[model samples]
Target: MMVRSLIDIFSAKAFEIDPLHFQDDDIHMKQALVLKQVKHVLHKLISEDPLESLYMVDIIQRLGIEHHFEEEIEAALQKQHTYLTDFSSNHKLYEVALPFRLLRQRGHYVRAEVFDCLKCNQREFTEKYGEDVKGLLALYEATQLGVEGEDSLAVAGYLSYKLLHAWLTRHKEHHQAMYVANTLQHPLHHGLSRFNDRSIFLSDFKIKNEWKCLEELAEINSCIVRFMNQNEIIQVYEWWKDLGLAKEGEFGRYEPLKWYMWPMACFTDPSFSNQRIELTKSISLVYIIDDIFDVYSTLDQLTLFTHAIRRWELVGTEQLPDFMRTCATAVYDITEDFASKIHQKHGLNPIHTLKKSWVRLLNAFLEEAHWLNSGELPKAQEYLNNGIVSTGVHVVLIHAFFLLADTVTKETIAILDDIPDIIHSVAKILRLSDDLEGAKSKDQNGLDGSYLDCYMNEHQQVSAEDAQSHAAQLISNEWKRLNLQILTPNPFSSSFLIFASMLQEWYL
Candidate 1:
């Protein structure tokens, strides 16, 4: 069907359709007619054919569910209002979109195909005609999305599109990318993009996101699995499996689910363990030296689906599956080792109540993930929603906080309570550092902000520099602030201090 073919031609340039450029309404009418016909073809297949069994199902979902939403159309309409000012052509699209959504929701599978058809045609229209003739096509595309948090979808789609476009330009393979980067095509991550292309084109650049590292990790995993003792991988897996992680199909196939398996994936990889693997690798020291990137992650720029444990504890975990628990404990042990090394040398007692608090934190993270996965959290404010802080990677934050706290309600489990407060402080500093990093990148022309900014801005003294990168002195000052908060600073806590110390070096 033309719907699938049109999938190869889509993105921002296609959806911003303008109608005033054409004086005759007939043109708009004709465009609408073609879209309707294309919809008819798609409707036949979706309604009557065995499309679910086909790989094209991915493509169909993208076009139907991801791209076409009522709010998507509204946002596009707002953009259109700016250009057309008083144009009614875009209204034609809304008329088409409502019925499309209803059909799809009702499981009128074949009729729903019309929406996908409209999206494909509109994408083609935008590519060919720009904003001038995109009217019904743009509406058709936008209306396929959900009304709730419609703006987020736009933001994410735009950002992904921008990065993917970058990767495509770098590789100079526009045609193949056309389909691979087609946002209207559904299964957003399944497609290729500028991020993928750029990372591949410049593999040597220390990347700032998990996905960026994914391809490398995969290669690393294969090598690690091949060379290392399967027994070693199996050992960790068995331990985790026994502890309630490492089982397949436990995670429900989303962001949290992905992170639940990350540590294991890394461990299973032989290449990843080799320090020579690139620069450093004590696979056991999963300090996830790399994910430090999460401190300032953002969806529009870049987002790390993992975080936490690096701070103090996991967010919500009421339903945190055993698989995630196993995953969390294993990785926390690895990362905490480094933190403990720092803590011991400095005379600070790293939070040792992980065993006691694991249940509480894991429960919180499970709830957080469930909420996030279910879309209960509105803004994804990690501090506010806890779940916002990297649903799965709470393993990292909880562990980090475990090493940082002075004391918690020792009444029940000594030192465990201090963790929540310590996590806030750490999350605050990290947020500042990240915000600076993000703002700095925006200044430099292609960097995404980190999680650190949000917290830093919430409390504490935040100083904005003309230069986006964090100043060494300022970061030190923040650390000193923390030190002042605690009278007996851990004299041995210099390594994690390494994280703060390296701010200037990493970003500047």
Candidate 2:
């Protein structure tokens, strides 16, 4: 599907779609002042209804303009947390779940047991609240945050999924049905882009005069992001053309624009243009390296390549194939340049740390390469234990932390070194999503074996359909772990959480 999607993107003519146009710069400048007033009016309006305040925060975030009013949103959530705690028993499912999700997403320490208040009534929830699709959707969204041993949420999530599916099937053409389907496809943290593409959210918020400003602001911000991203992508294409990496190998799957979308999704703010460019270049290199290991490289060549990465020096470049040499050189130069940027800006030398991440990434690749050659099928957990690292989440997080941090300290490095629960959870989700979707594909021979294959091999009685379902469940559970970890006290900057969430969108 990725290959087909890329082909469609590249094969299409530019003139097939209409170009986006906006007013002159002077007109946009005038609207900037209006935008400020709209933000103020929005803040004041949300301040009146605490529940609506939290809901609007969620909407603003989905609209991709939360950065404009971060302080105001933060203050509102903090106060809402206090108020919600005092009157905890008085709210409905939508009331409690909305604030809970918003707070935890912003790095607050809301407990999983907060949903304990709803556990005893789960059996009657659907029968009594079946018509409350909004509340059920909110409950379903909140359940995405379930951690280990949160039985209440596990049960609630199962019910919510079924109920929502039934509702969608019955009201297939309704707007609410469309919203539920979109939520199931991409949950809140990852669904912002798709949500913004539709007009429902805008119309829902346009009922009040003050919120009209917010709706307009979202439209303006979305346009800015679209324009900025298109220009940056053209620049990246020029850079990729100069490198000639795509022409050197037998592969035609090298898609720079597709790779750019991941980092662009992560850092949409105009301030991090450099980070987006740098991350895109590096991740594209990762895509190349992954293909080499999975398809092109022999076991002997992989060993040499892995050793070369571990050495982190150009001692054995001569032993590699022409393409591998090109890849290795690019990795070393790009990462070292990244480290240099950190050193120059923050006065901290991160060369070793950055290299360490690359070494670990390559080692994980080699581990899987070796496993594939041995004709031995490891258990699902064993493959996943190493497969998560191979997903490149850890390496990406390392770079993101250094690239976006205001200050780099020893404590921050230590926190990054620990492979916190958040990274693990993301890695798990990526691994499962990969296996689940890959199993459905007909082109399986040349690809690396997936977790679905491992599960099927281990349990001969389990059908492929069952195994796929199992993998889907694993992805959902890992999401819970990922959600829980973001709320824990941590040294990571909030930007890392946003990056992790963006990764969920990418891999899913």
- The candidate scoring highest on TM-score is 2
Put down candidate 2 lDDT per residue, 137-210, tens digits, no spaces: 88888777667787887888788888888888888888666567767766776553522445665543343665
Q: State every prediction's TM-score relative to the real structure.
A: 0.26, 0.89
lDDT of 1 at 77: 29
What is the model-wide C-alpha lDDT for candidate 1?
A: 0.34
Minimum summed lDDT over a 10-residue window in model 2 is located at 9-18
RMSD of 2: 3.3
Any runs in candidate 1 off by more than 4 Å, and if so which? 1-244, 250-416, 420-425, 432-477, 482-508
Q: Rate the local accuracy (lDDT) of all candidates.
A: 0.34, 0.75
Model 1 per-residue lDDT tens digits across residues 1-508: 1112222232222233333433343443543454444344434444454221111222222222212223333333233223222323344443443333333222222222232332333356345333221132233333333322244323333433444445556655544444434433432222222112333223322333422322332333223233333333344444334433224353222122122222322222122332112111122222222232232222321111233443445554324444343455555664456446545655544345443333344344344344434443333145433522322223344443333334423342343333443334344444444455456556433323233333344433654442333433344344434433322233222222322222212122
Best model number under lDDT: 2
- Model 2 clash pairs are none
